[model samples]
Target chain A: MMTIKEIRKRLDGGDISCRELTEAFLDAAKRDNPALNAYIRITEEEALRAADAADARRAKGEALSPLDGVPFILKDNINTKGITTTCASKMLANYVPIFDAFIWEKLRDSGAIMLGKGNMDEFAMGSTGETSYFGATSNPHNLDHVAGGSSSGPAAAVAGGLAVFGIGSDTGGSVRIPASFCGLVGLKPTYGAISRRGVIAYGSSLDQIGPIAVCAEDAALVFDAMCEKDPGDMTSVGSEPVTPKLTGSVAGKKIGMAREFFEVMSPPVREAIERAVKLFEKMGATIVPLEFPMLRYTLSTYYIIACAEAASNLGRFDGLRYGYRAESAADLDDFICRTRTEGFGKEVRRRILLGTYVLSAGYYDAYYNKAQLLRRAIKNEFSEMFKKCDLLLGPTVATTALQKGSGLTPVEMYQTDICTSSVNLAGLPAMSVPCGFDEKGLPIGLQLVGPHFGESEILSAALAFERETAGEFLKSSGMGVKL
Target chain B: MISLDELKKLANLAKLSLEGEDVDALAADITSILEFANTVSEAVVDLPKDEAAGAYNLREDVVAPSYPAEEILLNAAEKLDTYFVARKIGGTGA
Candidate 1:
């Protein structure tokens, strides 16, 4: 698989036409998608058309952005104009958006070719890709193992060389988890750093669209292109360009490690993270040991708040608007009831019910309100920790990719999100960079978390690690386009 | 544990109808999830005085041209010229 820089160099040198490059990717998708199930829909026509436009622009010597002519996949949750934006659910299976999502508009304006919509967990509700109505995305590394959710397809597609990079939304570990499992780089930018105008909301406060790429540098380029304030999404604060600041130097930097983050981690994951800490130390980074007791409460607080917001955000899926409508019903109320009951998957329904319970009159104070208060406590802890450390380092997940049909219960699945959810709760920037592999040869992700709007700092650190390691841990699945 | 009757009421509030075995399974799931969420109650922290105050800057209310009705209603299951076609109140047809 070629990096964006390699593709750009070839395009500039006239070694390859943009159309040919896009075709290569499209061909790869055709060959590999049957086994990987990476894409829910492949926009072959759109991709070729965009490739021609890119070639024409190059022919005319028009100014080009780094991502111009770059083919990438968008997670199914982000809307693309006139394209179906199913959140990997039956509810919106046939629903096409009339307008583009803000991030999609940004990418399209940059001349990024849309290959297709990547599969994901239904309504971005599950940690594993198995919950997707389209079906689970298989791990590119080992086909028997599952690709981590809910941005499973995006990560798989990128790892399988289906696209240069993929755009994914991370409410919890959706982006980073899969990237970790697939040996790729995934960034969940600070909340509100990117616009969410046309992103189908899961947890409005927690959800932020991010990049899944081969390396931190590629992730930085995509982030720079798509991060911008938009009137449509009032929460968007945009972001400063991080690519320019990626010095690949970690000298004199203080990296903090909280002891609590390791309690749930398996032995191999712990050793991998510890080795990464030693490598950073050798690169002149100071390791600061810290205790973050608040980690215990992040999972519960995150699930409560996320599900509560999800229940409210997903209320618009009634039969009257768009999406799947029941074939038969006795009355208006029955129509909506039947549609939702039939449309949503099991995991989505469970979350909606849980959210309904928390926000119900009597339980509001006990669950929703308590979670909010704990959210503040968690945020305050992050703020205090940032004062003493340049960045916090931890495991992206407690374990590697589980085999398909692991059949973990719902609560057990939610527990896997413990390492990644706190970043969203505090609206902090964080990323997963591949550090090493477990004994079973699955990738392990080392998480670099930064203060609010700290994308540059964390990205710089990631680039440094990538450079120092010479991408030794960034293994390829050897399945898709090898150009 | 959440009672089956309570789960039914919650499902009703969510506008979702659970039938037979699904009701039992969902009840167990929700109960376990709620139990997991109950861990938050044990957290001791200093509550902010302004808990309800949000920091977002509100955009000024401005009237703008809306999307074309046809385009907006493109994905609707059933639509008239400019409005969605839904079953009438107490109507029999789906």
Candidate 2:
């Protein structure tokens, strides 16, 4: 959880060379990857070369930025020029992006060593990383457990110490779930805060690229670099600069614990939230009770709308354009059918079918259109609640990391996102900070949700909570992460 | 409320071939998902009145040159010059 400032100090004092730092990460990745399975691709040769260039630039008295020389990883869904940008799907297994994602271009100018791609759910479809084509990323804390995903590999990479910090996409708790289970800091900034261009689309309205790191402040650093209005993305919002300041105290701030959100969680998750409330109270923050009955439909509305949009967005992957094309086909129809049939995985195909079903000619009004109305209701409920409190508190997930292939039905798996999905449906900013470990030594995460575009408040609260409850603890079982 | 037959139909529509194992798995997942679907239906019992759904003010539409056709087609397992070659259908090409 070394801050960017501390790492920069080490680099400036010659205590560590960029090459050594990059190599240290690469060497560690070689060791941990077998256990964690965090990376889809580890570009050691390119990363080392980039690190060498960074060192040369520094030696010439030209520093790229404060983030210069830092080594990091990106979720596979974010396009990287010349590197395969497969969204953990066979459909684009060999598809290489010709242009860099906007965030990639931004970070490149900062001279951060690109440690390569992390695995994710195919097309950012699933909450658990289990749906990936490559394989499920193991939780760094427990190899037998899942690294919560679709941002699975990025979360595992950062938490497992494969890299300092990694970028991930969150379209309904993808980033937060993994961050929670892996014991790292994960943030999903407001919907339009970051540009979505060049990043593979999931749910156009909900999909956003965020950061996962060992600590919230470092996430803030990466967050600052990611936020900007890009003309490429129609949804990008250019407004008030996101200047995250951790200097303020949480004393006298009002934190709301919604009764409705807490009703559906398990005992262990409840205990974690209780602990967070007590800690915030000790920090002199007022704990308030807030009610939002409309939140009950968050998951339902999310699935309907997300599927509808995904069905539309993913249609562009037809064999005629870019993506995997079927080797043998009888006609255009046969070709598209066979290619998509062969290319997409079960879970992805499931979503696409559900989406198409909901958006189809006859059913649109009954499903897709209804979901939109529910979405607006969910949004209104939060807006009213935010009027009474500065932040909303809850557990990131209902339970700790489940054992990989634990035989839970998909519905049971979907329920794990009960607490986190609502925030996404509301288009609010939220952070998952490691609270403590459960009885079995699994990490539990406390979620802090802020009003729209309230990333500064979210980060400040997370930083304060981490500073007080437990100094940053990396879930890396042994060698790397220490409290 | 969904049935195994419904799941099969959906999978076929999605162009996915499913085995008995997949159907068994998806049946349970889809059922539980519908429970949540019921919740959303109740919340929006009445859709919002006609007001333009907030549309994002898109930047001016400009068709810029993208990936070259050659590079884009390079990864295709089966392709002809400037076009992807597919299996002939209806015995027309034959």
Each model's TM-score? Answer: 0.98, 0.93
Sorted into a CAPRI-style docking class, model 2 comes out as acceptable
Model 2 reaches what TM-score against the true structure?
0.93
lDDT of 2 by residue, A179-207 (tens): 99888899999888899889999898888
Number of colliding residue pairs in each model: 0, 1
Sort candidate 1 into its docking category: medium
Which digits, one per residue and each the tens of the lDDT, describe model 1 over residues A1-483?
Answer: 678998898988899999999999999999999999999999999999999999999999883799999999999999888888899999999988898998898899999999999999999988778899999999999999998999999999999999999999999989999999999999999988899999999999899999999988899999999888887887878888888888888899999999899888999999999999999999999999888899999999999999999899988888898999988888988888888999999899889998999999999999988899999888889988988899999999999999998989999999879999999999999999999999988999999999988898999899989888997998988899977
What are the lDDT figures for the candidates, one per model?
Answer: 0.91, 0.81
Model 2: how far residue A150 lies from native, Å: 1.1
Instruction: Name the top TM-score candidate.
Output: 1
lDDT of 2 by residue, B1-94 (tens): 5787877677666655454346665776666665656565555355454434455866666888777888777666567788875556555331
lDDT tens string, model 1, B15-60? 8877533666777778888899999999998887347524575788
lDDT of 1 at A109: 91
